[model samples]
Target: MSARHIILCINVGSSSCKFALYSVSGGAESIVAEGVADRIGSSGGKIRVRDANGRSIAESDRDLARPQVAVDALFDEFERLKLPRLDVVGHRIVHGGAHHVAPEIVTPALIADLKRLIAFAPLHMPGGIEGVEAVAARHPKLPQVACFDTAFHRGMPERAERFPLPRELWDAGVRRYGFHGISYEYIMQALGADVPTRLIIAHLGNGASMAAVENGRPLDTTMGFTPAGGFMMGTRPGDLDPGVILYLLEQKGYDAAQLSRLVNLKSGLLGVSGLSSDVKTLLDARGSNANAAMAVEMFCYQIKKAIGALAAALGGLDMLVFTGGIGEHAAAVRAEACQGLAHLGLAIDPRRNDSNQDTISAADSRCRVRVIPTNENLMVARHAARLVFPAG
Candidate 1:
């Protein structure tokens, strides 16, 4: 098939469904169109579609009170535009446990298995499954692929993947299944022949994690059994002290839902700043509250510490990559991360860093630095297409 054939990649979240239309030809994928439907199941929802350059092609503010309804409306927009039928549909599933090491052709058995894994990532898995079902309903015979966020971390050594708990828990699949594999995989492909032997990829966004990638495979990562365990995120507690949980139960009489809400909703930068969960907001009003400034500082500190820890895991470091929302856009965060890494020869050219260039490393720097914008959607599409037509 020609590359002009489009692929629809869906990233269904609790509050939104992000869809991207891509044309994959000549081993490269280009965004043909993209859209996001926000506030699904809520009042005042909107859907905005844009072309490759992010120019809005169409937008609507109708009542999309359910995920299925929103997806139908989106397909209607594509039909109105006289777009070609999708060659494949890629869905991002948050966890795959040990079964799915890479993207797989979505079958009845696979869907059942994915449904079983829903307890692993309760907040993310349901919405993802909803998108998959919606797509399957719309195009019953269309090829579908499931790209796992934990698939890349299957590269982790048995030791790194294991927990300190009993073998019973380990056998029951209670171990680390690092999230954000698609992001790390995209970075690895971007590195191409320049792929580093020992590296750490920081995917900093609302939901963040750091993966210690060696030779383009995950060796160890910060995120644990769930996405809620990694480095501090916009609203997550990250690595929490076990004793704090005991205290919350004993002192505050907190239930599972209450604790989940506290850690996943009211923590991280928002908890520290007593302000917004967004980095841009914190940066804007950093002067207003010392707490806000401190929140950003602490965020950077945790990231730097994770980098150092990953370096230690690899015995040394050759490169460090920053991706995702905060990682690509925040120049100050990048500079601050490389500040004390002189010992490892990680130096950034001030001009390059300030300009938000991809290659921000100094010419003579010992360790390389790159700011690769992640394209999980494209990666998902490739995975799905590969599964559907293995020898294409």
Candidate 2:
């Protein structure tokens, strides 16, 4: 009998830290426990933990004023619950930059490299780096691995990877490094033997992007250079014309910080609607609120346009996948996006789509459309297991 190894996967977001414990043994894996420390650095912060069976093991409001505090609370909950010892820790790192394309054991050198690349992902990298540091401070001896979200697209062709910039810029690592790679990888694994030759995955959520994959490999992706460069998101205006930025700098007198704040925080659905960034909230109010309606329409339009573009990139479409928060649950959004895509041989069965079925495409449609829930934490755990127990 093979010994079981416990792996803890950590994903640090802007205002939350989600974690899960997975037990892997003899080529099988199962969740042991999972939890989140949310509203960090804000009032009414809370941490909640639950067992594998969905029973609440611990839940309480605490002053999670910092990432360190959240990390401490998570460890405390584990100890209080008397959970199995963690053999390894894994992190979902947003950007691996030019190098670090694979999961690697955490080290001072790796930490230093990540810190340098923080400029590449200002809103995301800090939390990930802080998570690593916090884990090191609490349990220095435990091994931690980083699974990058950009690693899955590292194999993209140069035409897809390169920006239409000067040679110096491309040489300086200023090229397309798509995000949501961990989620895409998980979707591919979930597809298993059914994986198609031409695939397009639309990971729609607050931070949305699409990828064109050919025969289990990435050909191109919607996002470029940074997460903010994709389709419009919950709080971002993706793929703005350079002229707009130049005008903002020259005429509006906006500085780099101000531009970053505008594009990364103020824009997107929230900016357009002048309301909440939550898609459900906007969708519910779209009937009465014109701004809300426009926001939702714009989002769906972008999704539709990207589908066409990616299908062209792949020369054709075999399968289309919808994952992430909006992709999995928003039936209306899916319908609107695929409204006129029959030309691509894609047709959504209204009944199946409304019910949120796994395979929602019509039987006669040549392109198979699926809704597969993404498990990035599980992907992270698997990467950690591979790095830690290579033979297993």
- Give the winner by TM-score: 2
Q: Model 2's lDDT to the true fold?
A: 0.94
Query: How much lDDT does each candidate structure score?
Result: 0.88, 0.94
Those runs of model 2 whose alpha carbons end farther than 4 Å from true positions after fitting are none
Q: CA lDDT of 61 in candidate 2?
A: 93
Q: Model 2 Cα displacement at 56 (Å)?
A: 2.3
TM-score of 1: 0.96
- Measured over all alpha carbons after superposition, the RMSD of each candidate to the real structure, in angstroms, is 1.5, 1.1
lDDT of 1 by residue, 1-392 (tens): 55455789999888798999988775567889998998988998898999889899898897878778778878888999877688888888899988799888888899899899988888888888888888889999988888999999998999999988999999889999999999888888888998879888889899899998776767899999999897888999898888999999999899999998998899999999999899989988888889999999998888888888889998899988899999999888788877898887788999999898988999999888988999899888888767776564
How does residue 261 of candidate 1 score in lDDT?
91
TM for every model, in the order presented, reads 0.96, 0.98
